[model samples]
Target: MRRRFAVLLAALALAGCSRLVETDQARLCRMALPALSPPDSTIEVVGQHEFPDGRGLRVVYQLEPPSPALTHFADCRFRQPGRPLRSDELTTLAIDGRPLSDVNLYFLVRFWLATPEARDADPAPLGDVADLPRLPRSAAYALQQALNGLPLAAIYALLAAAYSLVYGLVGRINLAFGDFAAAGGYAAALGALLAVGQTPATILAAALTLGGAAAAMWGIATSRWVFYPLRGATGQQALVASVGLAMAIDEFLRLAQGNRPVWVSPMLNAPFGVARAGDFVVTSALDALLSGGFALLAGLTLLAAMRFTRFGRRWRAYSDDPLAAQLFGVSPRAILAQTFALAGAFAGLSGFVMTIYYGSVGYAAATGLGLKALVAAILGGVGSIPGALLGGFLVGAFEAAWQACFSVDYRDVAVFSLLAITLALKPGGLFGVRS
Candidate 1:
């Protein structure tokens, strides 16, 4: 028994280590600031740009107030793709385009290991204005805000899709959509932590896989217990029960994790300087591009599948006439379960992007997020996927404009105001048919 237990422990340890490796390139990039300094002088990293192929990094930094030339940089070169350098393999170091002797490199490494930033390599940008294109002040500000808001829009769009899907099939809204998203956010953070390495590509893959799967499972369970019982009830009754379910999820998360926010360290948040107006500049990051692009791709793929597949035909048939679909041998419970699973998957993806882009997910984050998504669904035309997507972008853009032109305190108010206007004037959404 003792021997078998020992072997089990060893297997578990190896499994953990297999996924949590610190790659050679990640180690070198973490030491970017220290690599370019001698430990005696104060230096800070201003900008860091990775090579297209991921084997090289150009770190741009500056010395304290009085310096030799205002700016200096160091290029940390790595080996070819398959031949990654080991942690101890980096012997020679470069500082301000000059080679550092082995002796100096020794002290720098020791000092870096002692620093806080070295321990937590958060990818939050340190502001970049290098090589920014000239643009009018207003244009630059607008562009900057839009770049920041793009990811938020993607997140909203995804959550909105969840609401639309459920409403289209069941004639009821899932008020717990935000909590589902929050659950996905936590799962995604765990996925990143368990990734094979800190490389952007690998981490992204792990996060998406785990996050989407977890949320889909959560949705299935929710539909099983929560919505299944209410199938024979009125829509208002289901809506009220869903609201209660939302609160239950929130309380459960709060009690389980306490009040602390949970998330993985941000990675690849370095910005690309886009345009500038004097000292003011606009920047965007690859993180935002990946967020929006992946969301758009996922949304398009779902649309295509819905349009081209037999399953899509059945789903549409069920949505149009449940009695007819049942008469044709389609199961209502099965359809409902599948729809919830898909919605949960979208919500999970949204939460993953939110956590990755924003750096953390708090317990109460779901409340406001759910409210905004519900508004998006209603404004765009509830029960319509394309409408939800368009509504999400519009809401995101509106929030950006409000934050830029006015104070952010009333952003929610503005959004709710839009909801009121839409309901009062349009009644049915852009795609939703009027009763």
Candidate 2:
């Protein structure tokens, strides 16, 4: 608490000294589309180019609503800065990349001139200086989005591995892992309620810790009490039980926390430019790095333990032949309990990531996540650890690329299509051994 208070005080002191110092490029924003500022209009700067003189600016902007054609791209060019543009200086005004007539350019400028700020700021809004903001990333948008997709990829990898871990051990799918992730979110929320006035970083850290602990405990209990009883049962029986468990968990949380979604305060979201393409820059935030790094460490730790530890050997031996493992005095019940608990912990971490990444966690929202993780597992080879990781990365990359390059409405369609193609072409998955 004291540490958080001290940090808060320091941040406030820093903020008090900061001011909105506009960039040279932002000076161009106003001229690029003063059509942006009046009442209901929304502006998004999509691309920018600077002439050799540096004073000459050309940009592409997307304007929404009240705009002539509803979310159409428009182009603007200015030959001289720091003063109102002359008739010859307003070089181009185009819609959808087709240059409009000089009369249309004058008309748009006239519309901006009607605004109160433009009128107050300049005697001649058409001939006076104006601006909006920094010319942000254009070509770098895809790179930035791809970079952002990594944390989500890590989360999916963790969830996919959880699916693989249980499937390899028991030969039965535990569909409740996604629900377990939601349970972890609930645990985080409960912890957040107790942590008053703490910094966002501290809150996130605490949430993760509490979430993992609670989830591991529940996983252990469920495996021992619910799954253990079904030792000799068929796969469908266990699968149905898993679905029931998921529903019970969802309902329990809905009843416990109410129907409204639990919102998480966003943190560490100040983007810092990291790379550039042309004049466009790519940016990332500290939270992404922190979360992604943590997930990587967790994944590496799990892989190492599974590959080199006595537990790993025991697990592999049991997976190969449970009867032989029992003859060797290995308790099947103990192994099942431990494996499920580990899987639960990973799922919990995944849930924590999802909540923080999206800024909220919902009671029944994780069903899709679980289903997707299952697909990721199958796509990579259901029982293969490394395959799970690869599948998750591929899925995340696919979604990010599709969303960046094409319409977002079809992103899911693309993912499901990939799954269908993979299943049809390679039933055992990329890494799965032929049965």
Candidate 3:
């Protein structure tokens, strides 16, 4: 068991390390701080400090000799408000009464701004912008990113649940599940094109119906043709077939849709600021909210049905022991088909909402999206609905937070690394029962 676990960790580490290849100096500089130094210049972070209220951070950095001239007078830039560093805010560090090479800069970065309403109503204006009560950018940015992660997490959760449900029922992984999502996305895009100039409600209805139907059809076809015949076969045989089906589906999609991304114009484009803390502003996109809400509603409904309905009990019985279920007059084939249909519907709904939120879909994105959902399922504990939700949120937040702090290229590496660590510690997942 120990050796096997070690091998698993090594494999995961290699998977993550493969992407962390040597990057260009310019790219590295951008990942560090493009605002402070040129690509050729050497810059080192010496010290850092955060305000008690979490409104800002002060970064002290040392620059090598022959450094580029500082164009901006201020040490810090307010990214949210798009404000340049002011002359009054500049601070130069000196060593033993001698000025350091070029500029030894200390940055006081503020994240939040005074409310617009308060600013407008202030009878006595502050002399300097620094005098205005500001909110810490770190807190605000973190909050904003956390909120942003919700919709993505919700999508992941839905897909993860689907994967879990299928796996629990059949004891075989459906590698082609992501392709079902891609099918749904394509269907939604087609529906959008066909429903052009229609009301938002009509467009949404059409897209959902088309996308869900496409996914349901695909699921039914696969279960009946590929899986049903191999029902008595080994798990390895079923897995191989699923993988082949995934590749075939991917190729078919590429051939049918071409390589270009299909764009889906959102029905409602009105986005307004939903929350503000200091200078950090959080905008609520209609599609994101709708997607998150739909996922939550769908998940809750499914849980309720599983706990309360006769079909749910029968499904659970079949999942636990198909032979026993058959002995009790429950047809495993019918239940399995229904399970596939339900899983496909969930995947389809996710794809439809994701396309609407993102405004675009690509044939190639299916694999990554599906894999992430699988990761979420594994992280939460395979076959656990609530666990899937937790895993989805964690994955989403992990990605969002990493992107906010570092380069986007490393986001996947970070996610996989975290997964590897989590699995290493808890092989059964966060909520899975240990055998």
Which candidate, 2 or 3, has the higher lDDT?
2
Lowest summed lDDT across 10 adjacent residues in model 3 is found at 20-29
TM-score per candidate: 0.75, 0.68, 0.68
Better of 1 and 2 by TM-score: 1
Please, what are the lDDT tens digits per residue for candidate 2 over residues 139-194?
Answer: 46766887878877777888988988888888888888888888887777666555
lDDT of 1: 0.76
Off by over 4 Å in 1: 1-132
Using lDDT, rank the candidates from best to worst.
1, 2, 3
Q: Which stretches of candidate 2 lie over 4 Å from their true place?
A: 1-141, 199-201
Q: How far does residue 404 in candidate 3 sit from its true spot (Å)?
A: 1.6
Clashes in candidate 1: how many?
Answer: 0
**Per-candidate local distance difference test:** 0.76, 0.70, 0.66
Clashes found in each candidate (C-alpha, N, C closer than 3 A): 0, 4, 7
- Candidate 1 has a TM-score of 0.75
Model number with the top TM-score = 1
The TM-score that candidate 2 achieves is 0.68
